[model samples]
Target: MLALPNYPGDGGGLIVDRAADAPRYEYASLNDCPQVHPDSPNEESTCQHALRDCPPEELGPLLRIWRRTVAGDVVLEPWDSKGLTCASDVAPGARPTLTMADLKAQFMRTPWAKPQVSSQPKGNITLVNLTTFYRVDWSTGGFAPGEVDQSVLRGIPVRIRPKLVGFTYVFGDGTTYGPTVSTGGVYPKGDITHVYRERGEFPTRVLTTFGADFSLDGTRWDPIPSTVTVPGPVTTITVREAQAVLVNH
Candidate 1:
C-alpha cells in the first residue's frame, strides 16, 4: 500500500487517495495465539502469523509417550553392549497404536532384560594344564602318607585354577604340601613331577568340580582351596648319587 504524493498546504495542491489494506502485515510469531499470547511482555516477543500448529518429535502427543511403539517395520537401536538396540524410525499419527504386543512390551524395559537372559548360562572354565615328564629318583623309595607314587617323575612348573571341565583334586597339607596334581578340562597348562622317595612332611591340596551348570560369573568364580607343605627327608640321590649330591653340597 504505497501511493501518497499530493499535498501543498491546503490551497496550493490537494490530491491524495490511499486505501488498500495499508500497513497490513510482516514478520511475527513467537507464539502469539497460544490463545491471545496471554500477558506476553517477553513471552518470546510474539506477534502472530496464523500460528502453524506444533507437536512433532516423531508423532507428537508429547513425543509419542517417550517413543516405544512397536509393530511392523521395526528398527530402533540405542542401548548397546552387545544387546543390540532396534527401532528404525517410523512414527506417524500415533495415539494408542503400537502392536506386536506394544513392541514386546517395550522390549522388556530394554537393558537386555529378558529375564536376565533366561537366568544366566554362557560357558567357559579352563584351568587344567599339566603335561608330564619324570625320571625322579635320588635314591630309594618307602614313604606313603597318602600314596601317589605313580613312579618317580620330574617336570615341575604347576599352575592351575578354576578353569572348569572335569577332574580337579590335589593335596599336600603341612603349610600345604605339593604334588598330587591332576587338573582337567583337557589339560594343557604345564609342569608335573613328584619324586620324594624319602620325604618327611607333606600337606598340599587342591580340588575341583564346581560344575552343576553355572554362569552368572559362575557364582563368583569360586575355586580357591590351595595347600602346599613339602620340605624334608629326601636323601635318596642316585643320578650318579645325585651328581654326588650336587657336587658334594
Candidate 2:
C-alpha cells in the first residue's frame, strides 16, 4: 500500500497495490479528473501536466520546476518536453528553493536574438582557391548591453542582465568553428573566417551563448553562473573550384 499527497493543493495522488501487482493514479479534486489505470506496459500515467497556462497560485512547487525547465536551467528528464511537467509526480517538500539562476531564467521568456553575421559573398559560391572571410555584426538583438532591470522573485526583488558571451559557427561540412568574439571584423580579412576544401553546397549556422548576472537588492551583481545557447538562422554557401589564368597579348 502506497499513498501520496498533492502539493499546495490536495488534487492528486498515486496508490500502488502491491498485492494486485499494479499501480493506480488519482487526482483528488482537480477538474473532476478520473483515476488513471494502466492497461498495458506501453501505457503510463505519471503526474505529467502542463503548467505554463496554470494559475500562479496552483503552481506550488511546480512553479520553480516549470521555470527551470522552460529556461533550460535544469537537467531535463528523458520524457520532458515543452509545456510538459513531470515534477508534478513528485511529492511535496521534494523540490529545491528557486535560486537566482531560476529567477533569471523565468525573466527571459525568449532567448537573446541571433547575432547579425555579415560577411563577403553572403550567398552561394566560395572560391576553393581563396579563403572565405566571415564576419559577424553583433548589434542586431534589441537587448540592452550591460543593461539591468529589477524584478520580483518569490516576493523578493532582484536585478538581472543578459550578456552576450560568444558565438559558435557550424560550417555544416563535418567540421565546426567559432566560439569567437562578437565584434565584426574588417572586410576581405575577418577574424571569424572559414575555408572550404571541396566544391559542394553546405548549410552553415551560428549559435550564440549568453551568460547572465543577478543581484538580490539592485546592488552587487552576482553571476548566474550558467550560459544559455540558442541557434541562429541558417545560411547556405556553395564552394566551387576556380583558377586565375594568365593572359597574353
Candidate 3:
C-alpha cells in the first residue's frame, strides 16, 4: 500500500509500505528510492517499474513534495544527474515558481546564531531616586539590519535584510514595559525611564523583535510575515530613597 503525508502545503509525497502482508507508514528518506533496485542500482525496483509506465503528469507532484519534505536535512546539488533527468520530462513552468515566501521558508531551514546583547548602567550605581527621574544607558540592541545577497535556486541572487521592529521590556516589578521603540535613556536624559513607587532590587530584561524582508531576482525587497525575537541580557536595578539634610561645619 502507498500513501502521502498530508503536508501543510500542496506538497505531498508517496509513503510506501514495504511489508507484503502488513501495512505501516513512516517518513521516507530521500535516499530510500523504492523505484530503484535495492541490490543493483541499475536494475528496476518494483516502484520504478510501476512508475515507468505511469503518465508523466502524476510524477510531478511526487517529485516536488519529496524535495520539500527533506529540504532542511539535505542539500540537492544542481549536478544531480538522476534528479535532473526526471525533472526534465516535466513541462517548463509546470513546477511552482519560487516566491519570497518560499525563499523565506528555505532560509528558515538554515541555523542562524543569535546575536549578543549588552546592557550598561548610566548612573553612579544601579540605585535610583524614587522622587527623581530614572535613567539607564540604552543601546540599539544587537542583530541590527543588514543585507545579504544569497544565490538561491538556479544561481539567482536573492537580497535579504533584517530589521529591529520592537522590544518587550520586563521591569521585574509588578509592571511591564511595552513593545516600545525607545532604546531606554542615558544619564541626565530620560526617554523611556521609569520610576518605582518603593525601593528594592528589580531585575530587568528586554526581548527584541526582529523582522525580515527579501527580494528575488535582485528586485525590490518585499516584507516576509515572519519575525524572530531574541532575548537581551538581564540588568538589575536598585532603588534607594534620598533625603535632604542641613549641617554646619
Candidate 4:
C-alpha cells in the first residue's frame, strides 16, 4: 500500500493498494491535484505520474503532500521533477522608479533658510527725500547653492541640489518688487531701494525662490520641473516725517 499524507485543509489521506486484483487509488480532493482534469481520458494515469514525479522543493501552500510506501520498512519516496508549484513562481510587482516630479516634491519639503530683511536706516526712517536701502542678511541663514540632500526610496538612491534662483521684495504699503537674481547690497551701492510716499509704520518682507537639480548616480544631474518659494518673517519699519524748527544758538 502507498500512502500520501493530505495537505492542510484536505480531510483524509490518499491510500493506494497494489495488492488488490485491480489496484484502487482513493483521492481526498480533486482540487489538490490540478493535473487531473475530469474531461481528460487519461486523467488517472496523469495524476499517478504527477504524484510519482512531484518535486519536494516546489512544495508550498498547495503542493505539500508527502508520498510514502506502507510496507515492512515504511520507506520515503524520492521526489522528481513534476507538476507542483510554490509561491516563488508568482510574478512580482514592478520596481520603484524615480522621476523629476518626485524630486521636486522632496525639495519643497526640505528645511530651507528663511531670509532676514535688513534696511540701511535700521528701524526708523525719514519719509521725505530718503530711500530705504534694502538687503538680505546672509550671515546666519544664507543660501548654500551646492548643498545636496540625499535619500533612498525603495532602494533607489536620490540626491537633490538646491539653487537660489530669484528674490522678491515686498515693501508693504501695496508695493511689491521683482523676482530678480540680485541678493541686494547695503547703503549707496544697493540696487533694491524703496521710497515711502507717506509717513507711517510699514511691514516688509522678502520672498526667496529656489530651483533644484536631482541625480540618481551623483555623476549625472537632471533639473527638476518646478521651483519652491519661501517667505521670510515680517520686519516692521516706522517711517516718520522729519520736521525742522529754527532755534536761537
Candidate 1 error regions (>4 Å): 1-83, 86-193, 209-249
Residue 175: error of model 3 in Å?
1.8
Q: Candidate 1, residues 11-57: lDDT per residue as tens digits?
A: 32333553332221111112222332212353232111211112222
Look at candidate 4 and give me any clashing residue pairs: none
Assess the local accuracy of residue 198 in candidate 2 as a C-alpha lDDT between 0 and 100.
Answer: 88
lDDT of 3 by residue, 1-249 (tens): 233343323234633533333322223122223443223452221222222332344431222112222233343222121231223234222224333344456455433333322233434234453422333333444235564536464344555566667777767687767687666654566455566677787777777677776664354665655677766666676666666799999
Q: Whole-model Cα lDDT per candidate?
A: 0.22, 0.50, 0.45, 0.58
lDDT of 4 by residue, 168-224 (tens): 999888998999877787788999998998888888888888887776668866666
TM-score result, candidate 1: 0.16
* TM-score of candidate 3 to 2 decimals: 0.47
Better of 2 and 4 by lDDT: 4
- Which residue pairs show collisions in model 3? 35-48
RMSD of 1: 27.9
Lowest-scoring 10 consecutive residues by lDDT in candidate 4?
A: 87-96
Deviation of model 3 at 126, angstroms: 4.3
lDDT value, candidate 3, whole model: 0.45
- For candidate 4, the lDDT comes to 0.58
